[model samples]
Target: MDTDLSLHASAPSPPTSPPGPKGLPVLGSLLDMGSDILGFFPKCAERYGDVVAFRLGSWPAVLLNHPDDVEHVFVDAHEDFIKNRFFWRQVTAIFGKGLLTNEGEDWLRHRRIAAPAFATRRVNDYADTMVQLTSEMLDTWTPGEVRNAHADMMSLTLRIAAKTLFDASVEADVAAMDNALNDITREITARFSRPFVIPDRVPLPGHVRYNRALRRIETIVTRIIAERQRHPGDRGDLLSALMRAHYDDGRPLSDKQLRDEAVTMLLAGHETTALALSWTVHLLSQHPSVDERLSAEVHRIIGKRRPVFEDLAELTYTGQIIIEAMRLYPPAWLIGREAVKDCEIGGYHLPSGTTIFVSPWIMHRDPRFFDDPLSFRPGRWTPEFTRQLPRFAYMPFGGGPRICIGKAFALMEASLILAAMVQRFRFQWGGDRPIKPSASITLRPKGGVPVRLHERENS
Candidate 1:
């Protein structure tokens, strides 16, 4: 293959650099990036320049560290660079071709149908649902005691997603579903990073566990879909909306498509929001001033009442806290793409079939963009400050034509849950250890975040 590393076929060029990381002769840099890959790009940034190129089994890989270069990949030349099939292939084992996995026309088609269901009004309608479910979760939370905040948030948000999206609460079976989702996400993550794993049905330890968990998830999702189909539009939740939705050609989604979408929403809708909220609370716990301000905002806005959609605009600080949390720990940390044709970005030649990674985790915290990048300062996200930041510098939910369909829904849910939690409890760190980042699909605390919750008294 004549690699077309050129802006113009005849243009002169700088000398090509050697490929990054001399690993196993055939495997190249995959092992290096995969092992201790949690903050792989940051370490790479410290070593390489803003735009670093490497290889994974002869497949070219580029990691863009600067905001402008990140834009050049996701927004500026989006059409030319689609979601890498390999990244989606891992999800393909379970989700088939849901919105998150598909590319080109199929992605566009699914988005067209699912997008309206996540409209401002539709998502706003979900605020009451979020408040109602969160209130129920809070009823169990006796304050002034220590508990695993991550587990609590995950449980609460998963229930909210089930109720709001499916009109079906997991009830006693929620734990089983949670465990299954966690297993599946971890398995898929391992698969993505190590692509040479044997067939999942081969009964290796990892494959055995992963396959069993996937079957459980499929069974649970299918039952929910079948039950919802029987009762149909009476539910008035996301399942009903998707059940009623039609493509431009008047085609409703198939059972497989429906199942994929419902499960995707179940995982995507709740997991990321819970992770974001968990980190938000953890950050606030260490910064009493931020937590105090947030508590005051919630108290003044709702005053012992449940939150309403109308309260969102007035909940400005709540929104900032969520944005800042996402900046620090974006649930979907890395977005990957593959080039279909020769392209030139930032004066560098990108040949066809190159794999590219744009990491929100790195970009949002890049020292070039954020002052004191590691600090937990919600005030930094003031309206004016946000306006001054680069457009693609902080895409917690991602950007371009493939932006998160549930962006509106996730934000509303996060803010509502945060307000609902703040209205009652103040989180205090239960452990002296610093929170560490871990990932399977969503960014999560390495171990669950434990916090002592204290109920606010006297308003």
Candidate 2:
């Protein structure tokens, strides 16, 4: 594949780089990025055209707002671009060389080993566990009870992730895992945004807390791997599949590799899915009519029984609601890539090593692709609407070879959890305060989403 923009094959010469806002000397647009991470791209795109060039600290960068350009980076010439070193450097300490952060052949090998665990059949087998865990959590809630919807979803998903992936009971480690994950995510987000932040090796206040949290996580993962090795039995879980896998060269994964992959799955598997569900509930609360439609669909398809894998295909409206919610508030909001060789994107000349930013949050809401882009309308995701849209317009799970490995697992898990909860309870706005989005490792509800739950009379 040519590094130049294949979408514009007829262009006579490479186009000049896109226009961007001026920034401070040395610091460039780093402060703007640090100040409002979520708002930054749209602001730039509104001022500049589809493609914008700027800097993050001393690094040369471009932001691609159009779906065609996004497709180029994520799919057309994927090999010419690699994961942004600066962005991944922040969490590589925690994730190591796991599939989420690894690159090249190493990434391929890890992906190959982990792929079977997420196959349609295997993911389908885990559907019952998702509904069972969600039911258990819902049982603890009372009608008219006020709850932080974000926290509730997080706790529920974490439990589901643990049980489904590791075949471990939630009682032993869910609390500690939750605390550690919070601290690690907070610290990583802080370091990633600020260009002038101190190095992790230096013992800053945040670094100290981050290290402590990391150690707790390391302890938990190490113990799990150790116990699994001693038993060496098939538990019908992801961990078992990974343990039993071997490379083409007849080599098994080392203990360190096992730990890294396990931690990556646990973090990525639960965190983003939980956030997606939380945002879905928040959107439903504000749009009661949409909620009614969604509830009615769930009732008609699932009735009072727990959701099953086969019911997913029949719950068309329920799927559309989740799709629309993610379009508005994608958990993995921004994707970054670095040009390994000079390239032209949307006719812009990008030099080697240029950092490129693609935001699903911005693109999904682009008025060009979506009608009334800001409105919360699940009905917009009809078959004709989706079929006619650009492929890159709705990428909550990303795209290409490096797209999220857990995409199927997450969609299934979210659908089941949403279906189960909606059938039993109806949520209402619990407070007068408006909730804002916080762009951290994942897009999260600022503070938390406070909502009142009313149990259904029939349920």
Candidate 3:
């Protein structure tokens, strides 16, 4: 499908000018946009101008492709928008009224309840646990080994989350939690495309998978809560902290609410961070100069010693590399919103109940703001470069009050793991196959990232 919405089109009428992509009568350019999720954005920008309009299921969406436009949507007019139900309702089906899916008063209440535990000092406190778990993961790996970086990251992050969230030390129980988290993620991904398909009542695929995942999640979360109730101790993990939290009206979280929150943190906490770490390693493997620069920085920061909480500030370049990797391949690729009332944006009208989509995968790489947008360049994240960039053009953890509660946790975990990995090891690509972004709730490497991890000769 092709759209020619130019001002001068075969001299048709005396027209004032505005830029927009002309969509096909029905399907629009969605089919031409390709099947791969992240692959379509750059192409869309090339064909259309910055604010490109398109459609999905008869709902018109304006893709904000410039930094200024991104700023307008997220920061300037934030209150007018909220998380689109179409995208999050599937997640809410399992996680319930956890922080990620709710908005308005309920969201604010939950965020306040969850805030104390995610405070900066508390996140720093969890660094020790993150490092310990990361070291444990590395100890299992032999030097000069070929391994799936993705798999290693998943297991490592799950362990960190397990220890950090519940303070649980049982290996078998942790393994079970990891397995349950995986099943929940898979189910969430499947439900996105099969939105209308009724969940099975009995042992059907969706029903069976959903029930099994929910049961596993509930069993673990309930057991932890019960133990805390039976013999409360302030272990400094999130669960223990929440255990002591009370809402504004002297109300505390209900048992179901606690379970929902545990499910939310366990699933949201580890999954995206794992993907980001895996991608950072993969990008490092492909870009040797970058790898060399990062290795030098890591070695200079902590010679023959593991990273501590204080190391995060001095490891500026390492943080830049992670930021750049997320910019190139943000784990949470697409964010959506729905309008609750009639609204006008960029001189066009959007109706009440309209579904809106905002894709970071599209905006982060917009050429108007970024030079050589598709290329991986951590240097772009220097303090000076950061000051010059528009605010909402780079939101890996989202924006506004609804921004990820676990952003600090994810960053701390990533910085520590990346710094630790680079201090002792260098990774090289295992093959020539291109790693594509596969968006399924989170942006994942379509297949898997295979890399060779060789211990640094002189570290």
Candidate 2 local lDDT, 1-459, one digit each (tens): 675658657757657877997788887887888888788889999999889999877788988998888988899999999999778878887889989889999889989988888888888999999999889899999999999999888888888888889987656777788788788878877776566656787988889999999999888878878888889988888899889988889888888888889999988899889999999999988998998888888988889988999999999998898899999999999889999999988877899999999888899999999999999988998999999999999999889998899999999999999999999999999967999998877888987888999997658
TM-scores of all predicted structures: 0.93, 0.95, 0.88
Give the per-residue lDDT of model 3 (tens digit) for 5-73: 564457534322234446566655445443444556566667766655666535556565666655555
Candidate 1 local lDDT, 318-341, one digit each (tens): 999999999999999888999999
Which candidate tops TM-score? 2
Best by lDDT: 2
Model 2 earns a TM-score of: 0.95
Between 1 and 3, whose TM-score is larger?
1
The TM-score obtained by model 1 is 0.93
Clashes by residue pair, model 2: none
Off by over 4 Å in 1: 1-11, 14-19, 193-197, 247-251
Clashing pairs for predicted structure model 3, backbone only: none
Candidate 3 scores a C-alpha RMSD against the true structure in Å of 5.8
Quick one: ranking by TM-score, best first? 2, 1, 3
Provide the overall lDDT of each model, using Cα atoms, as 2-decimal numbers: 0.81, 0.88, 0.77
